[model samples]
Structure formats: C-alpha cells, structure tokens
Target: MQALKHILYFADGEFGPTQAFRRAVALAREHGARLTLMDVTIESGIGADLVKRFGLADDVQQSEQRLWALTHLAEDWVQGQPARLRVTIGTPFIEVIQAVLRDGHDLVIKPVRERPSSRGLFASTDMHLLRKCPCPVWVDREPEHAAPRQPAQPTDANADPRCIRVLAAVDATQPDSRQLNRTILDTAGAVAGRDDAALDVVHAWQAPFDGSLPGAGPVDHDVQLADVLGLLEREHAAALTALTADYRTRLNGGDTHLARGEPAATILAHADALASDLIVLATLSRPREPGLFIGTTAEDVLQGAQTSVLALKPEGFVSPVS
Candidate 1:
C-alpha cells in the first residue's frame, strides 16, 4: 500500500492539542510524511462575545493568546520532531478544507469531540471535514480524559492502547468494493504489522428482510432466511478470503465477519467487540454540497465509533465545495 506522505493535523481548540499533534508527528515519522499542525479561529463567536462582555479591548488578542499557548504546548511535546504550526482565523470548515486542498495533504488528523459517540451526532467542525475533505480523515479519540488514567476505550492487558488493532470495514455489495477492500486491508494490515497488532476485517450485510427473493421459497420462513443468509455469507466470506490470502503471514489470527444486520450498527458492534484501535473504511463519495452528501453508513460509523477512523473517499471523488 502507498503510505500517506503529507498529513494535516487540525488542532482541536486546545483540547488534547498536544497529544493530537504528537500522534500526527509520530505517524509522519513512521511514513516520512510532513506534519503541519493547524489551528482555526472564528472572528465572531460566543467566545468573542464573552470576551467583549468582559470589557476586553481586543478580541484578536484573546485568540492569539489561545493559539500561542497551543503552539508552545505542541512544540514542547514534539521537541525533536519536524513539524509546522499554523494558525488561521475564519470559518472552521472552509479554512480547514482550504488548508487540506492548498497543501495537498493526503491525510488529516484531529481530535474527536468530548461528547459521547453516537449515531447522527457530530461536532460541526468534525462533520464538515468528514463530508468535504478529499483525503482520509483521522479523528483522534485519545483514551484519556482530563482526569488521570481513564481510558476512552478498553484495551487488552498485553496490547498497547495507542493502536493494538486495526479494523477494516468493507462492503460486499459494491462492484468496486474489491479495490476499496484491498486499500483498507493493505493499509490496515501495514499499520497493524508495524505495531505488531491484529487486523480485523468486518463486512456488514443487511440480509433481505424484504430484499429480492431468490425464487419461490418453502413455507418455513426460518429455513428460507437461513438459505439466503448462508449464500450471502459464502459470497462475502469468499471475497474476504481471496483478498486476505496474501496477508496470512502478516495477520495473526485475524478474523473476517459477515454480519447480518444494518451496516453501521454491525460495524460499530464488531469494532467494540474487538477493541479495535483504528477503523479503516471507504466512503461512497459524491460531489453534492459540502455537508449534504455524507453516506449513511460512513456518517453513522464515524459518529458512533469508539475507535479512531481512517475514512477514504472513492477513487474519483470530487468535492462539491470546490
């Protein structure tokens, strides 16, 4: 797999900025990528309003102070690493999207919000980048909170919490899912190999609750359902096996599951079951308006995933914002 060479790390309002920057730097060092840490500020917002209410003479001064602190913190964390610090004041999504497109960044890293991971709920900034950005976006959900020693997701006793496992989510239905699956598999496998971790490939299938029937079925609904599911499982399993046959040596006890349920729900459940550190999946990209075209599975999995996600757009994806 072609490793990412240019990474754009979006600073998350001083919340775990240091750790997020460090992660970007670490991944950059791993792939010889350039790390650019960027922080965005808004000219008018609640914070600005609060500052004005406090009789502060300058709103820009306050923003500068915040960015200044973040820069120092990041610099201190990455003393010997090669990284760049960037600060921009504008609308968050537009500035971030501009940064990614302008610099030709192949990967983006930012902190996930502090709120609980759930379906259909995302921070505005995060949702914007996920929907609009052209490259893979890695939302960093650090295991620790402000308090000491509270891991965000449980980790195995022997496994390193940073990235003990990488999960690749694939869809067996799409005609081009083969290529996407290969990308996700190879990328996830490489990352896992580097960390001596496990790779789990999960494919969720919505069996025909009301789907097209194969033919006239027997009266027993359970029997008919079983027959249909068995066929689907075979096909999905075959695809997964054929793809994974080459990486037998790299993956130790890796698993491929053909789950019968909603794609987003199944993926999330499997990731949680495996305690996956990172999820790798491909989104069906469209050129609709910036926030209007997020795929259902992509949006839900991203919103509810406990682990960080590396989301990829389709081969010929075009951003509507441009």
Candidate 2:
C-alpha cells in the first residue's frame, strides 16, 4: 500500500488535543510524511479587550501557541516526529478546506466523540468536512483503553500494527459499481497484504419491496411480491458471492458478509461484529438518482464508525459545493 505522504490535522483550539492528532503523528512517522497541524479559531473584534477579559481573545499568535500546548506531551509519547503548526481565524471547515486544496494535503484527520450527535447522527463539522473535502478524510475516535505512558517506537507501514482488520464497504448497485468495488478491494488488499490483519468485504443491500409497489389482490399479490423480493435477493446475492469468491482468491483470505436491511445499519453491525480497524469506501452520486447514495448510508456509517474511516470519492465525481 502507498503510504499517505501529506496529512492535515485540524487542532480546533476549543476542542484542544485529540486522538486524531496522536494517530496522525503515528501515520506520519511511519511514512515520514509531511504533517501540518492547523489550528482554526474565529475571533471577532469590536471590543477586543472585553473578549480578552473573558479569555476568548484568540488571534493568530495566541492560537498558534495554544495549538502546540499539548504537542510537547504528545511528542514525548510519540518522539522524533515534527509537525509545522498553522494558525488562522475564519469559518472552521471553510478555512480547513481551503488549506487542503491550496496545499495539496492527501488526507484530513480530526477527532470525533465516541457516541454520535444526539441532535442528528454526525457532528456538524465532521459531516461538513466529509461532504465537501476533495481528498480523503480520516475521522479518528478515542481508543477504548489508554496506552502505557512510555513512548512508542514508530512502526513500519509495511508491518501489521496489531491485527489491522480492514473492512471494505461496497455498494453493489451503483451505476459504476464495478470500478468502485475494484478500488475498494484493491485498497483493502494492499493494506492487508500478507500481514497478520485480515480483510472483510461487506455489501449492504436493502430488499426492493418496501410497500412502494401496489398489489392487485391481498393473498395472490402477496405471494407475487414475495417472489419478486426473493428473486432480487437471489440475483444480488449471486453476483456478490461471485465477486467475493474472486476477491478471496485475490486477497488470499477473507470472509464475505451479506447484510439484508438498511445499508447503513447492516454495515455498522458487521463492522462492530468483526471489530474492524479501518473502513474504506467511496461516495456515490448519480444525476439520474434523486439524492446521493453516500449521503445517507455512507454518512451514517461515517458518523457511527468507532474506528478510523477512509472516505474516497469516485473518480470524476464532483461536489455540488464547488
């Protein structure tokens, strides 16, 4: 697998240091990649002294210093990795996105809460970034247990870090399903190549019958609808099964999971069941389709994913934001 060469870590001064920062350092150390620590804070000045009195005065200089306040501690734990700090004040995601595009960072990393937002599924900042960022975004979460206080040696990207179980999320029904599926498999396999970690390929699908189609007679039409659903299931399952068989041979070894329900829920269930470390997926948008496939299912997964998530946009896919 190709290592990430440039990574942007957002150190929102208000949220302070986070697991994403730690993980980004590890990734950078492994790949010897360029790491830029960006601290974004919005400061309005009419009564600047009043804001200072309330301890809310964070200009570029103060924000720069604040961004690195926790770096010494983190660097002590993860040594030999130096990151350039960026301090700016503007709308949070907008500034961050601009930096990514301007500087050509390959990945964006940010920390997220253990539980999803109660108001909706995803944090506003995270959702916004996930939707609009051009490059892949890695959303980091708090580890269940704390590591020992001693500093950790930088690990080789070629070697397995623990059992790096990879979960490749595939949408089989997309217009460009074949290419997207291949990309997902190629990435997961490359990461899991001949290592201690194993890959799990899962395709989440919903049965077509959701009472949307009308039936003529109560009993006879019920049987017909059931047959139609069964046929759809069989067709999809057969195709997925063939693909997984080929993947199993190509990847060396893995278990294929077929989930029947809402795509998001099914993907989450399988990820949790296997305790996946990384989830790789590409966003889906079609002109013929009313809404985005990735918006609902992928967004749901992105919000609830307890592990690191690598979200990719399909080639030639354009964001409406631009």
Candidate 3:
C-alpha cells in the first residue's frame, strides 16, 4: 500500500512496448517513482578455451547486442521518459531478484510469458518470481485486442487515468491469515485507487457439519446440520466483514463475497464471472521459514487464473536465491 519508490520493468526481449512497460511508465509518472528497464540473458554455454581456439567472439557479444537492442527499444517506447537500461547475464529470475536486492527496487512489473500451447499462461520464470521475489511482483497479461486510447481528463491529481477492475482474494478463517488478508486489501485498494478502478473482495469457506448429522434420527440430524451450517456461515461472514472493514468505502457497491467451497475454486470462479483484469492475492499461507514453496491455495489459483496477478509474500519471507 505504500507509495512505490522504485519500479523495475523486466523487458523480456519483446519487440515493442508491451502493456507491462506502459503500466510501469504510467505508475512511475503517477507516483514520481524511479523506473528501471532491465533484461536478462543466459550465461554462455561455449567455454572460453573453445572460443579462443576457434577464434570466435566471446559471449560478451551477446550481452552487448542485448544492451544495444534494449537501448534502442527504450528510445522508441519511452518517448522522452527517463529510465535506465541494463542487461544482466545469468538465470533470468535470479538476476532479476539480485537486481532488486542491489538497487532497492520496490516493485517488479513484467509481461506474462506464456508457455507453449496447452501448457499454461505463465512460464517458469514467472512462477519463480512469484515464489521468490522479496518485493511485490505484477505480472500483466496483454489484452487480445489493442486497447483504445482514452484521452486524459482533468481530474484529481491522485486519480488514475486507466479504467480497470481488480479482485482481492483473502482468507479470514485462520489466525495467521489476518496479516495477509489486510495486505491483500491494502494492495488491492492502492491499485484500484491508482487505476480508478472497481475493487471486489472475496473469501471462501466450507460447511462445518461433517458426514451425516449428530443425535436423533435423519430428520433431527438434518435440522441440526442446517443450524450448524448457518452458524458457520455467519461466523465466516463476520470475519470477512471485519477484515475488510477498512476498505468498505473503496469497493464498488461495497461488494464482498463470502461463499462456501474450496478456496481456490471459489476465488477463480468469482474472478471469471467478474471478468477481473487483475487479482491481488498472497502467495504464502502463513509465516514460513526461508526457502519454502508457496501455499497450495495460492499455487492452484495461480495455475488456474486467466487474468493478470499481483502476488505478495508474507512479512519476513526470505528468498532461497542468494
């Protein structure tokens, strides 16, 4: 929720100005944040001796070429916007994270790299960033059609020029979910405010009644089960309301959804129905030690999500990388 101070845009060797790049530029201009354009290339597979014997140029040429291309690409896309361009050589995700650590970048924005057909929307690098990046990571999906440009209006200074819808997914039932829930709401609110977009919050639960019923016969058991279900639903509803009380005014119609089902399924189904442009959710389930994988709910949602995602890690999360 804090104002972004430095944003790193990973230019993934795409030819033109991607939506993610434009978003990074706009956010920088809006928040007066520093913007850095970066790209990563793999280390050379050919050994130095072989290159020297063959009298071939070293892998440094590759880096030089990438830097040149990135510079020219920025000149075309930046359109007088100020930004620094750098090309790092190593594993893509590791280099990106190292850049964040070295430069104190607060947010990393990049276009979603799609795998081959039938695989998934996000590539492995995207998943690594989501799982490991210390700072917030925004993976933007490009629209199928070119978005029509809307003329800038003379509005409040803080108002965002773009119109987009954002969904915030949270868990309210567990004691450990409070911090992450609050974080989801705050980050979603900040994005909605920045884009002047509608925001919706979603929480999922399951019925408390187990198996058949308790005492008596089938009829009494049914009644007891219904009562138990109602109580549990109410408790969940209250918890969701309390978690989102601070964001009531920011929502469209003060909308909040408390549904009974699996968490990932409910969240994804609601997001699809709402046609959300972006989802703000936590990647970790609880406070975990360093080097742990993300929670199951988060992994399932990410795997199934059709829209862009802004993934956040819990406090004290440390990356396994470096």
For 1-322, candidate 2 gives per-residue lDDT tens digits of 4578888988655343356666677667767888887767676553778666877644765666666664653455445667777767777788888888788888888876334444333467777777777777776655567453344444533111433688888876666567767777777776566345788988877766675457457668777777777888787788787666667754445577877789878887888898887787765532224334356777777766667676776666554343
lDDT for 180 in candidate 1 is 70
lDDT of 3: 0.81
lDDT of every predicted structure (CA atoms): 0.71, 0.68, 0.81
Candidate 1 segments whose C-alpha is farther than 4 A from its true place: 15-18, 45-53, 57-59, 80-82, 116-122, 145-161, 209-225, 285-292
**What's the TM for model 2?**
0.79
Model 1, global lDDT: 0.71
- Model 2 CA deviation exceeding 4 Å by range: 1-3, 13-19, 29-32, 44-46, 52-56, 70-82, 113-122, 155-164, 211-219, 249-254, 285-294, 304-307, 319-322
Q: Is candidate 2 or candidate 3 better by TM-score?
A: 3
Ten contiguous residues minimizing lDDT sum, candidate 2? 154-163
Q: What does candidate 2 score in Cα RMSD to the true structure?
A: 4.1
TM-score list, all predictions: 0.83, 0.79, 0.87
Which of the predicted structures, 2 or 3, would earn the higher lDDT when compared with the native? 3
Candidate of highest lDDT:
3
Question: TM-score for model 3?
Answer: 0.87
Model 3 alpha-carbon miss at residue 65, Å: 2.2
Candidate 3 residue-wise lDDT at 269: 95
Clashes of each: 1, 0, 0
Better of 1 and 3 by TM-score: 3
